[model samples]
Target chain A: MEFDMTKPVPETQPWSEKFWEGTKQGKLLIQVCKDCKSKIFYPRKFCPECWSGNLDWIEASGKAKIFTFSTAYDMVEPKFTDELPYTIAYVDLEEGIRMMTRIIECKPEDIRIDMEVEVVFQERGGYFLPYFRPVGKK
Target chain B: MSKGKIAIIGIGEVPTRNMPERTHWDIIYDTCMEAIKDSGLHKNDIEGAISVTPQAQPKIAAELSFGKLPEELGLKGCKDAVSVNAGGASTSNAIRLAEQWITSGIAKAVLVHHVTVHSTIPIPDLINFFARAGVDLQWEYPYGTTYNIIMGLMANRYMHESDCKPEEMASVVTALRSWAAKDTNSFFYGKEVPSVEKVLASALLNTPLHKRESNVLGDGGSAMVIVSAEDAKKMKRPAAYKLGDSVRYFSGTCVMRDFYKVAEGFVVTAKEAMAQAGITKEDVSLWNCYLAYPLAHPLIAELLEVAPQGMGGKYFLEGRMSFGGDIPWSSIGDAPGRGHTGSGVSTACYVETARQLMGKAGERQVKNCKYVYQNAGGGSGFNNIATIWGKEI
Candidate 1:
């Protein structure tokens, strides 16, 4: 499939390149501070908790639970207008890291706080963006 | 940060409405002059200047950055001038900066002002711009979350944890808007006070939030003058004395922030500011917690313990936050009732507080106003700058 130009094409920095590369291979990678032993998301160059550059990556299990969510009935970015009635959420991964993503394969009424979810990737240009789905969904 | 030794002697604002007719420079100049005139002082009386950093810059909120405000305002060799940014806390942070200059005798007085234009950009693009600012451009913006959507997520979690209901949210909106309806200064002035049903019927921008639930930005700007107590006495004008002060900027972006940490931030800021003011929550005559959205109604109430758990909605519904109500909230209706003046809304909150303390809030003034507790922030709720004010030093 041709990459859609209408979709948001994310650029990667040096520290976030690995996470983007992992996504291209359909692997979810997260950062952990070797200094503080704290897991980090969003691929910062330094650990937010400890401000240490001594960070390493580990493959995330992709297991998560909905911390909170909201379904957009209207008023989204122009590019995402076609995906209206979409549910956006923040989920707490099993690794104790929180990340923002869209919830696919769920209805506005069915989504509940604390509901278990899993990650899936959608390709965008040279990278894949991670989105969450209810557990066991293909 | 001063020990009630400095006070806001003058305040100014333009109407809170879409004014494509006026450039940001015009708005800034108009409001600044209004404030200087209201202060009963010559323009040269202000020797120090502090500005709240403009928002959504290079398009609408641009061109006014750096420390050029004093020069732009024609201050002759001003002693000091700088800009401060902390999201909604911008103006509050600017006020603290002014206090430092005034108390340190770096300047006889300081002018703190803000301008965030919303009319220059199209609505959708504007939403996209603010959304990108609030989240990580790489990780989160691609996921299609606007400020409204992020706030929606927060509103859901807060409502779920606290058992806040949709009807209660409407009630809170209604109460907040009534204050706006009473004040000629509010954009919503002379507009019908929205009923709870009207709020429920309003279009939904995101789950659990009607279009009216959030503080959508508008073309607005405000300014204020902070002078030493000696100046206030010489002028023989009642001033809103700066008492306690606490300003903080925590983690950036709401998704990455810890809720408990922010909750603790609120408590700590409130405690420290109140302690410095030598007062308790009971002593506060007015409360202004930047309630950018409705859930903030209950959320702030609960965080500040103004209302018991999950009862913030009921508290608003009961009219406890309205004019003549216990701890009247936002004399001129604040962001939800007044219009969100970009960064200036926080400055405007202080303006309204000063008006109430000076017995000049017009029809919307809260009676017996003495002490005011205000918290303004960016990142929705991630950061906080809480301060206390009194009628006299």
Candidate 2:
């Protein structure tokens, strides 16, 4: 059973609507702090570090390095079970914040602690979800 | 300059569940009542309460139980009640809050509880939230990068760093299984401990880290009533005093800055807590460390100088968990026995130490145990907390 890509999201808070909207634009948007100039993920209005209200939205280039990662052989969910072995990774963005993304177009064994990767957006249902691929290689 | 003195006067815990069926509310109610009962006090006696749970609406405590709260355990004349959200660190961190309130003379007694219906919630999906926060969530969660895999990454790195064999980790599983087999309260009662060969042969969730090393997703809740030393003496239940505690955050999730810093940092935290408790590692009769993976023990041991270089194995020659027994994470080989519970796992270990201290643990009790050491690791690969608890504060 492939995860029904068309399944409606069961819940969505008001603030998170922007995040969902970003996927539609094929752009990854993250909040940036004014005081400390740090990037915030998890879609929060305030910065957790300095409690800075001076925040701005910035588009990311999505180029990152795999600080560490793992490949799953089992499918706990049926949505993507057909592709039994898949790689999920912690990609350290040039911005200094590491975001979790899937490594596409690379063998599981090829994933190293410091591999360079770039974001590739895919259209999942109506949302353009961001996955990553190796920079030089296909 | 306020001296914060918070003593856990009364403790209440539900029987552990193989797969927790009840809602967070059900578990909270049960443990809260047990704690209030243990305190020999009524709901009205509680002046302040604090809680940390997976649920967002903590005021449910007041709504469910007569205009009172932390959660249905019911506290009357309450002025200060907070719902903290620090994951596994929440329970003990709640203790820190209680100490603050009591030292300020704000609340004479504070009730803190953590519970969850593990079977009901989508465990895998929820754990993926941490991933969504950092990584490209849409990509990582869809195919691979769940918390388990993230830990697998850490475990892989750890294994590469040390000579810790899979068999040594399996021995940890065997010891946990051995203890759980004896504990009617444990989920794996009567189950045979998997042999080293069996563990090695198990599915590799992450390279060199087998599936058995993780914790079984069990359900349960644990409650502790924190009070001042004077208040504890008046309480009916025997107390497990908070001798000393510390919370430290390592920089970044990556292993760059604070990763290697953990071993030395752990020793510092432990030494500080021990010094405050007026005891040394030599005085600790039992040790219940939070073993997320097999690599933590040796890494921690090496860092603490528990043994000289390359002799970390010698420290475990004689102990409750010889060679790193039943770790709490992944239950990869059931090292800590059951797989992880969100919060209660750490609290339960503390409860186990409390049981041993009170002479309540039947067969598993350590002899002449006066002090017990408890460690709680939060946001794996990032936050670490250590606390020392004893019969005397």
* lDDT by residue (tens digit), candidate 1, B1-393: 546778888988888887888788888899888888889888888898887887766633344555566777787747777778777777776776777787777988788887766777666556655667767778677888887887788789888888888988788888888888888768888898888888889999889889878775677778888898777877888789888888656677668877778777888889899999999999898887675766666778877888887788888878888766775876667688888776777888888888888888888777688899987887555688888999976
Highest-TM-score candidate:
1
The C-alpha stretches of model 2 lying farther than 4 A from their native spots are A1-68, A75-80, A89-138, B1-4, B18-26, B40-43, B55-80, B122-143, B233-237, B251-258, B261-264, B291-298, B307-339, B380-382
Interface RMSD of 1: 5.2
DockQ of each: 0.56, 0.21
- For residue B342, what is the lDDT in candidate 1? 68
Per-residue lDDT of candidate 2, residues A42-122 (tens digit):
555678889877877788887888776667775234445565677766677887766666788988888777889998876
Shift of residue A119 alpha carbon in model 2, Å: 9.2
